[model samples]
Target: MLAALATFGTSILSALVPFVNLEVYLGVLATRIGDDAAAALTCAAAAGLGTVVGKLVWYWLAARSMQSQWVAKKLSKESWKRTFDRWHTTLAGRPWLTAAVLLAASIAGVPPLLVMSLVAGALRVRLEVFVPTVAVGRAVRAWLILAGVGAVLT
Candidate 1:
């Protein structure tokens, strides 16, 4: 349980600030525990999910707040309008788009949290899909890292 929490927590941390640098933390934990693929994957997934969840909260607030004139005044060239349009048409209304969005972000090396938070706020993707996607991506990333470690050791 604690491990899970830690994994999830790190993801949240990384999500909020793009420069948080989770790799050091992740690598340290994986190395210190004597190397376990499943454990590494679990931790990475949890952390990624935590970040996505945090972004979701931000997205909600931003979305809710955007439904007014006051918020619009602060944006440059009325960016919220564009954000809303893109969010609704490309992401919120579509399930496959969410996966694609998430996958693209991951592939582009966009920080998971930033990706999730922005998508959640911008697209308002359903939590059900967002969370699971995060888990799978993190798991894959962690597994790859473990594999690299194994290669180095041998």
Candidate 2:
């Protein structure tokens, strides 16, 4: 339980601080735990939930900032507002596509989950959709990484 909490804490830090590198921490943990698959899985679960919680901070911040007078003034440009509108419309129109992209970003880090979180919030993705996709995607990613490390060590 303590280890799981530590994993969760580390994951949250990694989410907030890009240089923290949760993968490196997870790899080190995998080596220490050796073949303890249960422990590795537990850590993965914690990491998944923690990452979502941490990323949610970014989401919330972006969402709130968008409503600010300063942000509204900055976005007063017609071109910028048009771009934002196009993206918002596209995302809103294709919910499944947004979810798929979120999942891919969370797992593969192709688009970078941090950026995606901000984008989702700026575009106003529902919490009901954002949380689950991110959680499941991150969990799968952590599990795969831990499994690979265990396999290599064994």
Candidate 3:
């Protein structure tokens, strides 16, 4: 019980920190908890919840700061402008595509969660859509990682 709570807290912290790799963390957690399927699933769920919470912070901040002077200054840069334009073009007018891309990125880590979170915010993805997609993707990924680690160790 205590370990699960600790894992939840650690997952949140790790998710917030850019340097912490979640897959490795889950692998370690799986090893520590042994082959207890219930415990493994609990930890995976906790990690997924933590990841969504942390990523939501980034998404919110980006959305809020879109109109800020600082963001304006950053966007003024040619490179930044190009990046923003690309993201806007790619994500705009295609809700299903945006969701699919975000889900794939969250589960597979192709474009990286940090990048996707920021892009989603900048592109003004609806929170109602973003939250559930990210949460479900993170949960599935965490479960797969834990299960794979358990299989390898046992």
Which of the numbered candidates is closest to the native, going by highest TM-score?
2
* Per-residue lDDT of model 3, residues 1-154, tens digit only: 7766766777677668988777787888778877888987887778778888889888988898999999999999999999899989988988888889889988998888888998888888998778888878887898888888888998
* Candidate 1 regions with alpha-carbon error over 4 angstroms: 1-4, 68-70, 74-88, 107-116
Lowest lDDT 10-mer window, candidate 3? 2-11
Cα error of candidate 1 at position 19, Å: 2.7
What would the per-residue lDDT of candidate 1 be over residues 21-102, giving only the tens digit for each residue? 6666666666654456667666766766675666666667755865567666754456756765655676656788777767
Off by over 4 Å in 2: 77-83
Worst 10 residues of 1 by lDDT: 106-115
Separately for all candidates shown, the number of backbone clashes (residues 3 or more apart, or on different chains) is: 7, 0, 0
lDDT of 3 at 106: 80
lDDT for model 2: 0.90
lDDT of each: 0.63, 0.90, 0.84
- TM-score: model 2 vs. ground truth: 0.91
